[model samples]
Target: MPNTIVELRDVAIYQRESLVLSEINLDINKGEFVYLIGKTGSGKSSFMKTLYGDLPLTQGSGTVTDFDLRALKEKDIPFLRRKLGIVFQDFNLLPDRTINDNLLFVLKATGWKDKEEMDAKIEEVLGRVGMKTKGFKFPHQLSGGEQQRVAIARALLNDPELILADEPTGNLDPQTSVEVMKVLQEINRNGRTILMATHDYALLLKFPSKTLKCDGSKVFEVVQKNV
Candidate 1:
């Protein structure tokens, strides 16, 4: 069987005092590209937070990139993050830094100290996302699509086992969204497992995969045709 990157069985997700999702059972294997779709306030963010060690997993059982969600500790969060990459709706790049500097900052923060090695790794990732020539440009210098590409490049720095993208294209225009989607699709095709949470149904129809839906306090898999 293929190796599972994310597995949750009978899981429950919460936001502060209230429960948001219950009875969640999911299996995302290596090299799979899955889509997470739900309406606003439908526990999508809560579910993503649970996976990334933001919200504690208090009920059921779950594992992400070999880390037990139920047993994850504050100190362990950084290590867990190294094994997984997270992309948010906002680019989150430091506005004061150039794209290359932004990526370098993450590498240093993650304990990469060798300048030559870091530079080589940065080049590799930027090339993968079609932004090798634009690394010196500031965040504001690039368009939304380019900024998102840089964000994706930043996520790839650690060679993560899984990538969690939350509304990655939510801020871009329709055409720019397609560009970002194509970049993501290319990454998936190259064997990186990705779970993207989005409300963009048009993208669903354009590039369908194993889809999961969060609705009515539950998370379940849905066939692409029905989505």
Candidate 2:
């Protein structure tokens, strides 16, 4: 049996008063690398927000990493988020902090208190993304790709069960995008489940997987060739 990490049934996604997606049913099993693809205003962001508790599931039932989306309280959001890792398009790193400090901040916020254990985890995640030696540099000191690698490392600090990457490579050049993609792929190969939202069709062709496309206020799986 497949270990399901994300499961949504009869789910409706909303942004404010507008309904973005309706009657959605989806499942993402553990150890799978799934892609969410769609044009702008096609409900992809809304869907992801609903999963991460940024938007509430007002009209259906859903669960991400075992937290009930519908019953997820504002206070419980932080706890839910700890079980999942999120990556953003622009590499949301603090300009004032070095890569190690940025990652340390996350660990501290998530209740990791041991100095030696935190240091070991920081090194481990950075090593996973091949950013082990770049931890001393600030975000502005690194290139776009390198900053994103640090972001990925930061996401892994909690050892999340599911990773939600929202347009992770949207700001990179083609070659740089591939370099970042390779890091993500390496993470997935090591048994992490990843759900990435992207509009880059070129990446779809290069690293095809189970893809879900948001269209016309509905989310459905598309065959790899169609993607």
Candidate 3:
């Protein structure tokens, strides 16, 4: 049996009282690279948010990295996030900190107390994303793509069971987008399951995978030809 990393059944996603997606049944298995494609307001972000606990799952049953969505508690959100890595469109790195400090902050916040272990982990993840030499640079010192790569490396610090990437290439130019995509592809190749939400159909053609489309308030799998 395939190990399922994310599963949702009869799920309804919302933002406040507004219903975003409904009757959503989906399964993302271990080592799978899945895409969530939709228009700007078609609930792709909301769907991703629900999985990562940014938005609550109030109308359905769901689980992410073994945490029940509906049953998730306030204190549990942090722990839940620790098991899952999240990459955002905005590259949410702390501008005031260097790349090394940015990653260190996460490790410290998550309870790593050993200095050597934390440094080793930061090195490993930065090397994975090809940012090992640039750790001393601040966010402003790198290009958009480079900054995004650092953000991706930060996401990997926890060795998450699943990665929830929301438009990771949204802020990059065409060429740079492909660069960041290559980094993500490499990470996924190494056995981490990734569920990325994006509207970039061009990327779909360049690097096709199992895709799900959110439309008319519903989510369903779409074959590559249809995507």
Candidate 4:
């Protein structure tokens, strides 16, 4: 139980009073990589949002990085986020800023005050994502996969306990998606817990891990066929 990073029991997630997923039970341990798969409107996004404090959890109980989801307040969201990294379907980079600036902005907003330390962390994360040399480039100058790599780099800047990726490869071509996936896989290999929401079944086949599927308001694990 001590190594569990995310745990939910009898949990129900809702969006503006509409119950999305109910009676969910999941336990993710430290250094694990889990996949979330489902069709459109099947509550995968809602479930991910609930984990990162974007959506409120009104019933049952859940916890992420030791923060209780039911009792989480707005003021506590930032603190909660500091322990988690979130990646969106769209590469949410600032268009006008270079990749370095985009990463720097997050560091500063998250309370990084030292110039030297901020720069060091920015480089370190970019290096992890294999984008160290591209930091001076603007987001528009890079390909979709490159942009997503930058996004992943940004996510790793805080040394988060968990990385919640919501359809991260949704906008990329197949090859590009794999490239971005490698970055995430490498991060996971280095001990960062990952929960990725994806519709690309090919990825599931290629880089299979423990998968959970959202179907008809319930979440359950996908049974892997014996090879």
Candidate 5:
């Protein structure tokens, strides 16, 4: 049996005395895809923050890719981030740089010393997302979907073990959302775990995977065995 990639045991989060999440217990194995659904301000973003170290772990224990999130040091965040990929609703690409430069910047920041290897990796991931020809283009030059593809490429540059997407397709049209879902699905099929927080029930019906829902100030595994 394989080890768990993401584990949250009795995790709790508070926003300056206001508790956002209460007792979130979960275990995500390698290569699994999960949907996180909830209302606005229902601690969905807070959960993502906890996983990425944006918010300090206030209670309970958690781990991502073997890193003890509760005991993680500040300097160790970069290392943990390398094992986890985070995607956003708004494509956070550097408008001033070309797509290739955007990816190269991350590689450099992550301590990549070989320029040739970085360039090769850039080309490889861009091709993987069908954006090989757009590496020279700036973020402003591409459509919404194209820019998002570049962001996805950036997230993939490190080849993370798991991808945490916070409303990845929230800003796109219906057709474009499907396209983005295809990209994410392909990534999952290739053996990377995906934990996407989405309000799109169509996506849930279309993809059909485990659903982890944030409700009643706690995160629960909503499934047939318990339903």
Candidate 6:
């Protein structure tokens, strides 16, 4: 077992030749839940993008889930992402698809062939997230929290080692936000490392963890607690 599942040593990221994150050094271990908090345009999303291989590395070395991000091939991008689960503030469910279909789509894309196995996997994850009943429901029918839970189930479909969430509760109500956080916490308890970017300070204080703040083209810990 590796102590560090995500290692970013002296890594730099750029968009359109403009630097976004410079010299970011991070060593995130397995089974850790890290709260990634930062202001907008402070490279929170950009950093997440880098972790998921959406942005090309302009400088330095990076490795996510044992794959060299700086040296990642186009064909390997999909494989790299298979080890990562991402959640966003906005629920990105397919409007035309049911919850079960959405999960099935991901399974098929990731090489899950047997319908029985796929059905069992889908049922298992949805049950774990407390949305097994809502699996037949459409995205629009569920509440914001329910939809986000489905999104979480989708992210877990590939059995990802890490989760990179960007403001996952920004659009939900207070009670619902806390509920979603509980579900995320439950997932983290099951040995998945989660790095979530959020603007919700109340939730941060309520469920404090290793906090990283991105500002002034730098990313660092907020306190010794983060260490």
Which candidate tops lDDT?
1
Model 6's lDDT to the true fold?
A: 0.89
Overall lDDT per candidate, in order of appearance: 0.95, 0.91, 0.93, 0.93, 0.89, 0.89
Considering TM-score, which of the candidate structures 4 and 6 is the better prediction for this target? Answer: 4
Question: What TM value does model 2 have?
Answer: 0.98
State every prediction's TM-score relative to the real structure: 0.98, 0.98, 0.98, 0.98, 0.96, 0.97
Displacement of residue 52 (Cα, Å) in model 2 is 0.8
Q: Give candidate 1's error at residue 87 in angstroms.
A: 0.7
In model 1, how many backbone clashes occur? Answer: 0
Worst 10 residues of 1 by lDDT: 1-10
The local lDDT score (0 to 100) that residue 177 gets in candidate 2 is: 93
Higher-scoring candidate on lDDT, 2 or 5: 2
Give per-residue CA lDDT, model 2, range 1-227, as digits (tens): 24989999999887889888999998999999999999998988888888889998999788898898889999999999998999999999999988899999999999999999999999999999888899898999999999988889888888899999999999999999999989999999999999999998988899989999998899999998877
Worst 10-residue lDDT window for candidate 6 reads 218-227
Off by over 4 Å in 6: 224-227
lDDT tens readout by residue for model 1, 52-91: 9999999999999999999999999999999998999999
Worst 10 residues of 3 by lDDT: 1-10
Better model by TM-score, 2 or 5?
2
Residue 157 in candidate 6, Cα distance off native in Å: 0.7
How high is the lDDT of residue 216 in model 2? 87
Worst ten-residue run, lDDT, model 2? 1-10
Question: Candidate 1: deviation at residue 1, Å?
Answer: 7.0
Indicate the residue-level lDDT of 45 in model 5. Answer: 94
